[model samples]
Target chain A: MRMLRLLTVIMLLFSVAPTITAQETITVDFYFPTATATITNPEAGESIEAVFNRYAAAFEAANPGVQINVVYTGSYTDTRNTIQTEIAGGGAGPDVAVMLTTDLFSFIEEGTILPVQDFIDTMPDGEAYVADFFPAFLLNSLDEEGVIWSIPYQRSTPVLYYNVEQFAEAGFDAPPRNRQELAEMAQALTLPDGQRWGVWLPTEGFPIWLFSAFVIADGQHFVEESPSEVYFNTPQTREALDYIISLSRDYGVMPGGTLSWGDGPSIFTSGKASMLFHTTGSLTRILNEAPFEVGVAFLPSGTAGEDGTGYGAPTGGGNLYLFANSTPEEQAAAWAWIQFLSSPEIQSDWGAATGYVAARRSAWELDPLASLVARRPQYAVARDQLAFAQKEFSAYRTIDIQGIINSTLSGIISGATTDIEGALTTAQAQIDSLLAEYR
Target chain B: MRHHNALGSRVADAVTTLLSLLWLSPLIFAILLSFRPPNEPITNGNIFFGSTITLDNYRAAWSVAPWLTHYLNSIIFVVGVLIVQLVTVTMAGYAFARMRFRGRDTLLLIILLQLMIPSGVLIVQNFATIRTLNLFDTHIALMLPYWGSAFGLLLMRQTFREIPFELEEAARIDGASLWQVLRHVYIPLSIPAYTAFALVSISSHWNEFLWPFIVTRSESVRPLTVGLSKLVATTDVGALYNQLMAGTLLVIAPLVILFMFFQRRFIESFARSGLK
Candidate 1:
């Protein structure tokens, strides 16, 4: 009787399956996370969703039987978590998603993300198009064996933002070129009255600006050749950390938590901070809202004790990926959408509108916005800084590294660990333990 | 002697008003912040009593997404869950309250055990279950697990117990069947308990984030809290504070209004349950 019932079920599915496939339209859900802070700008304005919808509509017009539905996933982190849940559950996840590059390496390891090399291989101009992305961006998107898993959607490098008015008051004609001068200028501009602090840096989602500077300063490798080891407690690491710690204790230039969220970017906008180290992506937001004349410059060189050369901050942003769970037709439809968005014309427009750097070098030459930035000397600073762009080696458990750094840094700031050497040593011990687990 | 009584009454009135203000401060702050633009500098004195009221924030919040769709989805989700719960819990409560069967005690113990397990622990498994049923991205998926509440069952079972057995006997004697006895007598007598559970269920599911976030991927099925949180998390604060505040106020107002209207009944139900 059980066998008979099973035979009947199989027969029922066989009959019904063709009818389901005969449906005209294939619907793909695209989950988008809105910014955590409520954007006052209407969706009709400069938000990514507005641009996404325009592309979605255009894609639908070009492709028959393809309907793209966009849903708001809350915050960037929440979107990642939400999609992970869906994928883990073996349910319908987003066909394509915008995810932080910092997270890609780990996600791919867990078999959640589809490697894009196969998808790109089938396209006519896929190789050329893939090559258009900045070389530095490959770090986050590629595996140890160099399999491309995702395409760069948005990218940002940290730059120094200073108040022009404040700089003039401090008798500085231009932004400081190196770390020592930058610190001295901060001390010069800082007032005893609770009016302002000299410098601030956000410790939020992408604290890689500080981390990259530290790594580069210490001449430490972010990840070993095999992508297995992270050197967090090298001599350069200690020296770089000691300097940042001094900004608060020794220089008296930083008022804690003002420049940061949980120690990130709140200080600068509040007018309590004169200079902020933050992403170029934030430039648009600052321009839209800052009351003061903002000046942009490359991050100051971390004085290498002997060479006096400073390292560049790490690049941060999301990459677009096609999920493996999607149907072949749906995957093709998603590929078309991604290609349209990544086109030189579209990328340039997006880069101009939003503060994201253009992923394709070709877009920079052809984009009107790029030309506009070229005319402005300050924006040119970012273009020049791109030469030294670094991407975090999120391969060795990025979140764990951050946790160790945050706890150690928190202890240093709170004066709980008065000795930076001891605190950093403890942190390195923890990081080594984590690295050992991965081994 | 009468003067002393009057002074005590004044003190009581003063404390009540102060407490009320304290409870309402968050609402007041949200309203105040909603008027400021994102990234606009807000010094201590510029806000609070001195600032001009504005509607730009509300306009921004409305335009950010299809918030109206979110509201509709939330209503559908909350109502669907509550209605299903009303049936499932009432039936289960009736069973456990009146009916006697073999291993009944063991069965009740198993149901009670579910209450101790944290909801977070079940999320990944529950999501998998929903996927197996092919209910992902639908309102039905969001409502499925909530159809029966273990706590609601216990509360309703107790509520049914307090009613006289004579009522059930009278209905049965009048030629009413067991189903009719349950539907007509036990259900009506247990309205307060059901009302309590309804409030708890609706408010909790209304404010819930992860489950709906995980299950529903389309705006057509998204609840308001998720929509509101998405907007809250991404925007620049200085530029959009006022607008975010307005959006927040609109998102939370319905629940606040519902609470205001049902406060007395809610408290009384809880009080009764507490006694049990």
Candidate 2:
């Protein structure tokens, strides 16, 4: 009698289970990293996580039978490490992740990420969608064959942040236009007794980004379209290096040793440094924290281009990558989430909130960003500089190659090695060997 | 000679005080920074004190992550690991110290060899094992890999061997079963060793980040370290040191309180167990 009762319960459970399973929601796990913990929408006052949740909620509401599980993976490095571990463990990692734009080659080599071009090709407005993003921001997202591997989300370029009061006091009506003027103004603004320096070019953690600007302004591409090629030891690159070293050693306007990247904002805002070479992602913070009026401009150029401004910068930030490890349904859902994030409306709100440059050119025409740029024109400087911006230095085995370049730059700048050409040549050889496998 | 001895002692005390202050400087800075007003950064010549102390950093840090769930998950993870570790380590320690068996030394040597292997290299394999067991993203998955601690086993074995063998013999002669002998004789006398091992196990596991981060996906299973990491901004954007410090204080407060409450016992246990 007990066995019969158990059999009846089992039969009932089987009948009910399939109906429940039939209505199951497809979950797309989305992982992202924030620029800072305190990222808040200035208008709505929503926290970063709350903003993400709101987007997910909106997306879910639009597309029924799909759920977006947003995970706050730490920094870009941590997110990459987590995904790598997940893949190694034979588990499908997050359906989508926000990784560094330079991480494109490594992920491509790993075969873990699916090219978004596959999804784009199927869309009716694919060409228009691809054309809408800022060309500079999309530079790092494309491969040698020009296939789009990722979608630009949080993007930024390094801009010159100068103290307005200091610039005025030093009798400067405008920010420096060229390297000579930059040094002259920096020297004039500098105070004696080490009280204040003219400029603080942070060299401690990844100095390659700003340094690449110098290389670009001097009419040399830092890295070619090929993943295995880099122009680290070129004459233009050497001239850029010598000019940077002279700013500290001969000009006595910048710091002498390895200036910490983490200290740049505070050092500028605190009036310890008159000008700062830092990311536009830090624009909001610097503007908010500066007691004096903050001035933002393009980084001084080494040589003028055809457009008549030698001004150049390298775009640096994260992009949305879709993993190949998901189901077709999940991939479609993930692609939709990426589009929703990169859409003009959302991008404008995100840019105003977090100080990242909106990847889409159309996002600038939207309300919050348009009004904000109107109120504070510093926001437009990064946008204008994008015309002269180039891809951040990226190659096969990017992290290791970046490490070599960073250490070599640090060595020369810190006076550990006065042989700038020799050090860079060695670094170039090391990078070549590391990239030889890819070639 | 008496005067000279007093002078030497005075110098020693002064040196110790200097060393202690040096060691405490970073903590002092963190505490000071945590309370500093968000507008007044240390670079503004406010290294020690800002114009007005505020809880804004704490408030901002608190709102960023789910701290309550993180604390609960951390407690469950550390306590769970410690409880199982005590059982396994005690039994293994007893077997190695008192039992007679073939290849006992060889088995013990192999187990001890795990102490030399860095836990980082085992992350992928352990993660695979966890996935195979269908335990990923669970609290048990966070604690599973640490259950059998080689260091704990080795510490317990050394501690057990130092005990007088006559105590165990006497208990056995009195018709005490192996379980009774262990419970009444070995365990009670090995309180200091057990306490020492427990502190080491709990603190290390509590502060663990990589394994928990790799294994868990939900806020319900992630620990405090993972939560603390959310406060770290990317290097490009300069750090918000004030909020980072505040978040750190929140994550470490429980450990600090535990250590303070058990200060005397912890010191005595370490001393008695011959562990630094």
Candidate 3:
């Protein structure tokens, strides 16, 4: 499966290893998740891996003596754990890798990744490159010290997806704008006798990000932006969880069970639910499979009587990171590769290939993206939602902290527990201990 | 046989058939689901059989991942791990079963202790060890941790012990060397145990995902289970049940085919292994 890549690596090591002149062959390993195992499953053309390979070749050819090994590490967490394990073992991982932006603090604590600010300070025109991306997309990348730790890559957000035909049948011309209307509309849409429900909030899959949308809608950051603290026991978190649980318990709008994350979109597309909340990453799946018209909207806002801006989503997905352990030349090469990958041209291509939102502001101006948005329009919803997006919920011990909150939310929403405040308190306790060292 | 006994035997056979079908239902269901067209959402009814059946999902699954590469990697990993384990376990089992040595019982106790310690519990240390050895991103990394298998050693020891002492004695008296006696006598007679161990080792390594996933940085070294995982990564297409099932069926196809071809031998080996 990796014979081609391995040969390239070997030839690259040979080509660069012995070079003795001013061209000090910078060998950089760029780790990112591949959408397919297609080095084995090589498709016809323009697959995500193909695009990256093309970029790697272009970068290598464009910069003589700089070789890029584009390694397809399995997933975001897989890459993070791989790097962390290596770091813990007194070794360096990939020169550059795609780290989950939510894992910014964990990576910072490990002291394994060089802040992008370091790269920017040394690289030419790096300021403009940093500024080119949508500011909302950079919110998670920036730390309290204002060091940019990462660059957005394949970012996404959750959105409200509804069956437009069902909406029309229910006499609604537009999607719900706030929590109250959503409840009322969901009640009207649900027909248990007809074997259909109103709405379903997937209990398990990326529940932390999904809950972030809820907490944001209620007008509170789920955790402090400094990544030093959490606000899980606040009114916002409780109100959000209660509202989620109430849909099943109080309003009877959604079913009371942990609807598997994998089944969420299919449940909607199958006409089992009129509306579902999920990542905009799923836009293609919904559009292709829906038997009827579908509409995409920002997740409805909370009933906080806000100025039409209470709704927000967590900016989700991986970020490009430079490993701290790489040599100056390799780091410089990594920075160059990052710049090439993050350019508006590639970002737009990436967004189109995968349903991730284009991370750069300028990407929307590109032709196919512009035309695609004009036609499908739903493709634009995740981008539009970015305006209201907060940096995704992040803290020290990011995964475990979120796991605590997700289990609490899932438990309450699924009727496994009635104590929202108590669950939040337990989660808060566990996280507090986990982050105590940082504090 | 008496009528009652015959009737009871027939009834037991029916029950066993029903249980086997129940056990096999998940595999059957996955295969059936793989035949579904992508447009069709999986439902309770679709589990029986879909209204619209197509091999489109299989084509899509095959085109999306390199199952052949995964198949090759899996074979390499399984065979590599097993070959190493066989040599190590056989020698260790011979020493424990026949030769007298100090701390033998204590050593056996320690080996058995590993059987109690879940492989997952050692993942962090093993990962650290792998990284330290600079074996990350290689198939050897996947094999290193399992090379000294405690269960295999124990299974071999039990099998060697079960071989009549008179056989080893006969070989030794015939002027066979220690290695020769063990090889000619113990190894030859432990066919069923060897088969059982081979079966267990192959399937276990074939199905292993987590450790291999953690170790492998690229597709060349990753096996079918890891490749199948990419199918479910379903970043956007959510579950894509048809495609997922298709990929899963393809991953286990080699094993299933092996089982089908070697069903009698497999059952016979296990039955004769004295496993109980």
DockQ of each: 0.43, 0.67, 0.48
> What would the TM-score be for candidate 2 when compared with the true structure?
0.97
- TM-scores for all candidates: the values are 0.88, 0.97, 0.92
**Per-residue lDDT of candidate 3, residues B14-74 (tens digit):** 9999999999989887888888766666665446557777988787677665667888999
Per residue, candidate 3 scores C-alpha lDDT tens digits across A36-106 of 33222111234456677887888788899888887766666666766766666666688988877888887
**Two-way TM-score contest, 2 vs 3, winner:** 2
Clashing residue pairs in candidate 3 are A38-A41, A40-B66, A41-B66
Which stretch of 10 consecutive residues in model 1 chain B shows the poorest summed lDDT?
Answer: B234-243
The whole-model C-alpha lDDT of candidate 2 against the native structure comes to: 0.89
Q: Give residue A374's lDDT in candidate 2 (0 to 100).
A: 96
Candidate 3 chain A TM-score vs. reference chain A: 0.89
From the highest lDDT down, the ranking of the candidates is 2, 3, 1
Candidate 2 RMSD to the real structure: 1.9
Error of 2 at A373 (Å): 1.7
- Give the poorly placed runs of model 2, Cα more than 4 Å off: A1-11, A14-19, A305-307, B43-46
Off by over 4 Å in 1: A1-31, A34-46, A63-71, A118-131, A204-209, A257-259, A262-267, A305-311, A327-333, A371-380, B1-18, B41-51, B170-176, B179-185, B235-241
When only the first chain is scored, the TM-scores of the models are 0.86, 0.95, 0.89
The predicted structure with the larger lDDT, 1 or 3, is 3
Q: What is the C-alpha RMSD of each candidate to the true structure, in Å?
A: 5.0, 1.9, 5.1
Of 1 and 2, the candidate ranking higher by lDDT: 2
TM-score of chain B of 2: 0.97
Ranked candidates, highest DockQ first: 2, 3, 1
